[model samples]
Target: MHHATPLINTIVGGLVLAFLLGILANRFRISPLVGYLVAGVLVGPHTPGFVADTSLAPELAELGVILLMFGVGLHFSLKDLMAVKSIAIPGAIAQIAVATLLGITFSTVMHWTLVNGLVFGLCLSTASTVVLLRALEERQLIDSRRGQIAIGWLIVEDLVMVLTLVLLPAYGKLLGGESETMRQVWLDLALTLGKVAAFITLMIVVGRRVVPWVLAKSASTGSRELFTLSVLAMALGIAFGAVELFGVSFALGAFFAGVVLNESELSHRAAHDTLPLRDAFAVLFFVSVGMLFDPLIVIHEPLAVLATLAIILVGKSAAAFALVKLFGHSRRTALTISVSLAQIGEFAFILAGLGISLGMLSPQGQNLVLAGAILSIMVNPLMFALLERYLARHDPGDEETTDRQPGEETQLPLEVCHHALLVGYGRVGSLIGARLAEAGMPMVVIENTRARVDMLRNQGINVVLGNAAKPEILSLARLDCARWLLLTIPNGFEAGEIVALAREKRPDLSIIVRAHYDDEVAYITERGATQVVMGEREIATSMIALLQLDAAKLPY
Candidate 1:
């Protein structure tokens, strides 16, 4: 009984190594993406170690692509894209053109054919959505004008790449042989487009009604496991059906499935429920890409690796900066957008793989793309750090400071003064918020959950959506103007950080924090919490008071 399945071995090995490296990367203040790639290289065939099953890795990586695109579709908002269309659409197109041109010039210098050059160029033209979103969310910039513009631009780039993915095979066939005429190429393209259009129409018309109904039924059962299973089934089922029936890419099918599901009220739960699986597969996707990379490229083809990095870090960034500035935006906006786009990730790897499958890209090109992705991801945080410093010194009155004022059409009340700033809208915080609302007291909630924020807003409660640990998010809650800061989240260390920050921002602000342990209470209080309420301590106090009352009621 030979039970040593290669699939199991690959998954186990990849995940364990990736976890170890990811932690190391975080410890060093580097993106976990860099670590994941490094892990892949370590377990790769090129390295002196246990190699994973390369054959199964790609299939798993495809699943990751489907789930990743589906998640994107869930968060996708046409309204947000339209709001910044004037700048985002044109700026993204122009930047992609510039990047592609630079990539093509480099490819030509390397003596590649025009078709190969175009494929290579296309890979370099787009930025990684995962990296961009993580960066923006970490900085609490996801809702800012600058973040909106950058996100909108990335959306445009994604749509273009999706279209390219659909059309590339036909283009490849035409370029590969004389048997395929230009007319044949156009005909094949039209047929592919027709299938895609038909698939999208089915999703919008029928899927929109069916998916929500399925989820609603699943929700009615009140089974968390069933609901999670239903969401995953929808994602994977639609992806498979699209390829089997419509001759479309799994990524496109999964994306449209997500867009359809996004219309349902259960969409947030769907996203949250399936996040763990999505994240796991996404990591595997990165690991698979790393497996394809040969570290000797740095030694054997250093110039080619450098050229790829230049296109990603310098050429693409310069184009984005020029495009944003040409649209009459400020220097800060230009810099933000530029730095945001200065890395490549999942999409680049997907494109590179497709190019290789179609015989349009060489092994060397794929390795170069992988090398560029790793290096650029490693350098991205430094770029952001430099930008932050520049803004602090030169643009001292940047948006974070100036935009804190009320009457900016924000959810916070303009007339409210000495209001309570409530952090975390979970169990304890929600109870406190309900009491304050009943008493007609002014309150603003700082919560990171989007679904909770939406619910609060619908009830006419003011809420700020972001991690409260960040100063910018706290600033958005107007800490200086707040009279009381309440930390209802259970994490003692995190709560302490928030207390310290609030105290520094407003020395006179009263702070109350909840803790689960006696040591946590002491820790929070030492960090400047005016009051630390421990659950066990309060329970004991109530019990003692009740015992005394009972004794007094007795004859004694």
Candidate 2:
């Protein structure tokens, strides 16, 4: 007896397939998003397989968008958002106009009406917030200047999409020859803008107070379940309320909710608790997006599909690249911003659906949008990889461009032999450096952060300024003569790469690396680390040692 379980089936099928393909994708050095989308395509109605409920998937994906935005908000403060506004605001608007114009041109070539082309252009203009955030988080760049600018730019795009969603219906009335007055159109636009303003103002003024209070009260109960539930309730409830009463998008609503909650002392705990749910739902979001893609669109309208994808990939990226350059940013910053905005996601789907409902977009147009989204998203990670390689090849010395004096060589002094090479100078690295300094030990620090590198230089310490993963940076540390290679970076994979490089350069060099997990320990050790200090294991060992001590005199 088979029970009717569409929701359960959808969730399980999506997750299992996503997991399997995700592993395969990672194995091949591809982004797991490609696998998730592939899984969706397999289970999608367009394919000959067990089709999952498409309607439920998007709703589940919406939760992903909400939670992802919420998590971003947790880390992004009001100050950070305001800091990037000068570049993000005008750059985003200009990029959107350029992409939209490109879209309109494509539509005209296809003999589409002006309204249809407008809808199509709009769909192609906005980048998916979820994709951009995920990319930043993966690279650990979410807090970087480039990441902040990308995020702020995305926020502006979201606002524009929200306005478009609200006004599309009124536009529909006019398209349908309903004699809708220009006054009504203006009224609708004003109402949407006013509501959005009110929501933002309310969240900033009232929410900043009430949200933290609620979390504090929940935390005081000492019930972890209650606390987690309170977080979810606030995220979901505020999002729903924003939609129902405030006419705001769920992504924006949940973002403000997280922003207010960020003021709470337990915001870190909140983020930690919801991380599993956030990741799982984010996978579902990608899977759901995949399910919408009809592969036949590619077969039937190859040129049109290619044209749409070119708009998303090339046209949008070039426009963004030029805008960032116009703002006097570096080639690296411009490339990063451009690549980040080269894909459209949830908002595009929403706008495409609305367009179809309003008769402004045909099914073919919607299919084209879906195709563009899937292809662009799948290739986005690869684009980033290329950017990394390009940067590595051309700008291996990240700080050497303008900061370094002409004819300066990044070599250790002839007197500084048998010195320890520290790969990071963050919190852990700084503590180790202090101890080394006190002992009067000679050491060289390899750090990527400009400020930290500058501070180290001012302290009269030998430091290499660039990513240690670069062979030149490693060579600058005099790895051949270094007594020890200390890998203190939190990123285990990156640490492993540096370890391997150092080992290949100096087989007898003692390599000590810090790890947060057993797998990291194993990976780094396998790459020739002499010792892997597992933080949790060390803490446990210390705790056990304390337990063995005499209880009466140990503490009161």
Candidate 3:
């Protein structure tokens, strides 16, 4: 319990440092994490400036990691976890085991003690979920099978990371203390695991019951900040409690707490609230990591760094590819997933700190490892990007995203091509869908509704369930190639924004905007919109057309 001044200093410093470095990193096309590391090194005791309390940084970093994992769990619903589990679990396990083995081999070759080698291996086995998820999003692969498999693989890595955090320390202690009995070590390890299990059970049973009620009661305050604070308290409190009382790793507790909240209505909201802080704190975690890098190691021990990088990438990726394929997948899918996940993560940051505290490895060795971690963090995204391009070009699993409508899109006024574009798939969207199916033009409907996604999918149509306003949805529809964009939502404000956003991306897109008011018709027309339909005008236009057809039937 220090005063407010230090707390403010720590937060303000971390945030300012993060923002500036992040911008710089962005400008350079480098991982902002590297910037965070650089920022930490500058502020660390090794430098002359306002040195932060050494422990303060990691403590704050723990907050970031916990929130990040919590956010991951919150968004990674039970459905998603189960959906991807088939590949993620197995892929993750094989990757970790292989990477760890490789790390151990390298350390052993370097004449490290057996314990040090194993610890080194464990650290190398994890991947930064944050970096990978962002990369997946950027590459727009989140909806693909490879993305699903990659996610599942990461879950396995996370589980292994937790186990290593808890079990490795005991192993290290028993190995180091010649007098410590094997029986004693086993007892401690078992107790630790039991406590971890019980902690998980308690969080699931008790927390599931309590958190929703808390969120429900608190949400009416209509204060986003309060909601954010509540989420933070729950995450940090459980994480800290596990460490203080049950002797479980904070990472495990944080993850379990996130799992408990997976069932809550506020899961996504909770995730949104925690992300900014997670990002800032996560940056510190990376930055603190950078401070540990001794420039001398790279200069004098070049082989060590090169060897570590090789073992992490080539050895781990190969292991992952083989294990995943053996488990059940095409070689292409397995290779793509494994290759993408071949790097280290923030968990290793915690592990490195633990290793230093336990004196298991020399500071120099730890520095080299931290340097490697930063380099990996920086490189992981680029590697994933390269792998994505390679998979797209070569793998069947790398199919380009397309919006398959449940049925055809029918409209009063429209353009037609090899495909029909359904802008909104609500009740109106669905009705148009049925008509289009009858006509048999390849129909492509883009919708924002989640419930109808599977419903449409069940009907053998390519249903893109996302914001139609986004250029990605437009590109998915192949707007330049597709002849029409059927806009169903008649809200003028949303329509304008969507139109603007679309035009910004694709200037020649032909959209038939659905309008409710006469003023909006003028507004839409003035903007050079292709067409606008008023609800009243739709009935009138059909009535006149029907009359004309009736007159023609009279043989006039």
> Against the true structure, whose TM-score is highest?
1
Candidate 2 lDDT over 286-387, as tens digits, reads 999999999988899999999999999999999999998887777878888999999999999999999998889988899999999999999999999998
Candidates in descending TM-score order: 1, 2, 3
Q: Mind giving the per-residue lDDT tens digits that candidate 3 earns over 1-556?
A: 2565765666667667867997998898876666776777766666667656556766777676677767655644445556666557766776677777777778778888766777787778887766666566555555455666676677667656666677667777676766767787777667766877787678767887887678767777999788888888888888899889877666656766776776654665676567778767776666555555555666788888888777767777778778766766666666666667766767777787788787776565576677677667667766766765776677634132221212323122123345777776654666788998898767777754333555677888766755565565566665656656677763555576667766666577787787878998888766656888888898999998887765556864
Report the error of model 2 at residue 505, Å. 12
RMSD of each: 5.2, 6.2, 10.2
Stretches of model 3 off by over 4 angstroms after superposition: 1-14, 45-52, 137-148, 176-180, 245-248, 330-336, 356-359, 395-556
Q: Looking at model 1, which ten-residue stretch has the lowest summed lDDT?
A: 404-413
**Model 1 CA lDDT for position 325:** 81
Best by lDDT: 2
Model 3 residue 133 distance off true place after TM-score fit, in angstroms: 3.9
Each model's C-alpha lDDT? 0.81, 0.87, 0.68
Candidate 1 residues lying further than 4 Å off, grouped into runs, are 1-3, 62-76, 176-184, 187-213, 239-272, 400-413, 422-435, 445-476, 481-500, 506-556
User: lDDT, candidate 3, residue 29?
Assistant: 81
Clashing pairs in 2: none
- Between prediction 2 and prediction 3, the one with superior lDDT is 2
Q: Over 4 Å off in model 2, which ranges?
A: 397-556
How would you order the candidates by lDDT, starting with the best?
Answer: 2, 1, 3
